[model samples]
Target: MEGYAKLSSLISTDSEFAMYRKFGAQNTQSLLCYQAELISFGDDLQQLAASDRRSQDTDKRLHAENWYELSRVENGKDQQIKKFDKIRKDNCLIQQTAIAKLDRLAPYNLRNLRRWLTRSAFGSSFLYGLEARAWDEVYDHDLLAFPRSYAENDKDALPQLFLGPLLELFHNLIGRLYKKGTTKDTLSPEPLIRYYDSNILRVADILITIISSGLPIASITALNYINRTITRLVVVAVFTVTSSLFLTFLTSLRRTENFAVTAGFAAVQVVFVGTATGAGNGGLLRSDV
Candidate 1:
């Protein structure tokens, strides 16, 4: 219960856990390749920069200097300013682009689908699931269940722009009606009808404003909480029924365990209502009764 409360709080504060918890992602980029390629590029540039001809510089003379640019010149002098400048510009552009690619964050994700393709060729995937290094690959267990992702499209849009969950209900219904697949190798669940919290939160806020504006709400603090609970009361009912149906459909749990979980969920809501009532409305109860 405590963990779930924290999770709900986290979902509202930062979309970070929401992305990881309810979406599919991958780790495909290779950090090793990125580092190696960047190093190779830098080494080549350094070797050219340090090159000196005449052989007078001893071993410090790299690439023989003269041999560094052995390509035949088209129509310029042995080394003209125009040709050299153009060549330098071209090489710098290429190198800069390569550096930018290497600096990208995607390449460091070694757990993506690219690792599977690498299993046969480079054997780099042998260290998968080792958990030794940050760059090391790991099993796709956490991500396999989420093969698809929803980004900004998943949020509820105001004024009827986006309706993610409501539309998903139709997609699920159509897929089943069409009998889309021939095989039953996998499972396709029809998710419970879900409504995002934005609307409910807005409604709750409006009700609080109305109650507080009309009365001295500090004296009726418990009443305010009770009103808030009543706003979500329908949602609690839906969750209880849906949870029971899904539990029976998916799990082999004995009846006792199922009843306990189902009842507990409802009881938590009722307990809140009862607590708020107990705090307020002393006149509703009598010692004579």
Candidate 2:
């Protein structure tokens, strides 16, 4: 009976041991399945991370491309603006040249107007002193050339010959002034009137009358035209230089903006690299591990 009891105990213990082994094997299989699932989840997460990285890279690439395209567009726009501006400026310069030429051809009565205005005002009287010495010499010579002797010389006969031409010249000038009505507005102050009290004007007028009275009308006219032409040439040169410099400045500004866009794209690239590297280095391992 004791032997049978011992055998039964041994069998029970063996059965329990076998049951424990079976349960352990089932648990091990469950753990293995859980590990496999975790591994699959990790694989999925890795795939997602890789996909996110690729997406980010694609986004960055697209952004960079967009920036590059924008830079190209800006550059093209800048060039176009410069070209259009140049054309417009050239047209304006041409118009100015045409106007200048037309002005040169138009013959306004500038000389006649100046003479009439100067004569009507006290400007002519201001110039009387300059010829006073020469007039005195002429009067003295006239007295000596009188028909009668100096003892029989009459003041009327002596002075009439001397003053007649001078009075006639004054009357002729006065008649011209009378004919010139106040038709036109004053363009500039008359130099004769402005300098009526100036001794310099008398001195200059006397010198000019002595030196230039013998000059032909044609020579005077040619000299005046030369002076006018030189002034017009100077105006045209200034306009051309100013227009060219302004255009150059505008072109440079546009080019600078275009280059700035390119630099912005480069900066974007740098940021993308830093962000991608930082993301890769950060912890992205499976939580299950």
Candidate 3:
């Protein structure tokens, strides 16, 4: 239900979206370059783990042949290597950690990414940007796609996940469209992109208030003349489902959390229906007297 201004004006004044549009490529490149570094690091770790002089190989020889002390005295083998076994523990830890880091790195899929980003930004309207960057040489990070898309699960980080697609989509759609449009008009600054999360939170708070308090009384009043029992149940059910979906899409609530909120919402509606119905019935009975 967003109203739109003149198309030419919109094209001219939209600056924040333009910034993000430009940011998409740089962020994607930065993300990829950073991933390349992580891959190189993991590969190097694998090489170190694979080398012949690795700790595990030393452990096997030391444990099997009791070669803790080398035949050549200058080799300076650890006489207590088998007894302490710290080297093997260190080697095991390295291998385990390397496997974990490698698993986080997935093959790049621009197609899936495009779909996800579009979906997150409300079918290419360019609502808000995400914060997604997977990793780099100095840091390995998790992917975070809230209201996560299909390709984006619990993993993924900023710049790569959110900001990347959000910006790219804006550029591809708004940026491209603006160029062909008349130069005399431009879209104004986009507050939606600038204060996206805050706007979402504010809307969420308002929705919560409506669902918890307003809807209950409204439903009762609307359905006051209907078959009290069946109509109230239907109204309550509809409110529950709609609110559940709203929370799911707009906020990052889990299924259980949504359920709890929905349950409370339904409870209020049920209480309103019962109390109002009872009061009406009592009034009618007194009138008969």
Largest lDDT belongs to which candidate?
3
What would the per-residue lDDT of candidate 3 be over residues 178-282, giving only the tens digit for each residue?
A: 544333332332222222333333444554566547655666676676656777778778877877776676456678988898888778777877887888899
Error of 3 at 229 (Å): 2.3
Stretches of candidate 1 off by over 4 Å are 1-29, 52-197, 204-289
Q: Mind sharing the TM-score for model 1?
A: 0.22
Ten consecutive residues with minimal summed lDDT in candidate 3? 14-23
The Cα RMSD in angstroms, rounded to one decimal, for candidate 3 relative to the true structure is 14.5
**C-alpha lDDT of all candidate models, in order:** 0.41, 0.35, 0.47
lDDT of 2 at 209: 52
Between candidates 2 and 3, the one scoring higher on TM-score is 3
Q: Which one wins on TM-score? A: 3
Q: How many residue pairs clash in each candidate?
A: 2, 0, 30
TM-score against native, each model: 0.22, 0.18, 0.38
Q: In model 2, what are the clashing residue pairs, if there are any? A: none
Query: Model 2, range 101-153, lDDT digits (tens) per residue?
Result: 32111011222222432463412322345442322323332211112121211
Error of 3 at 270 (Å): 0.8
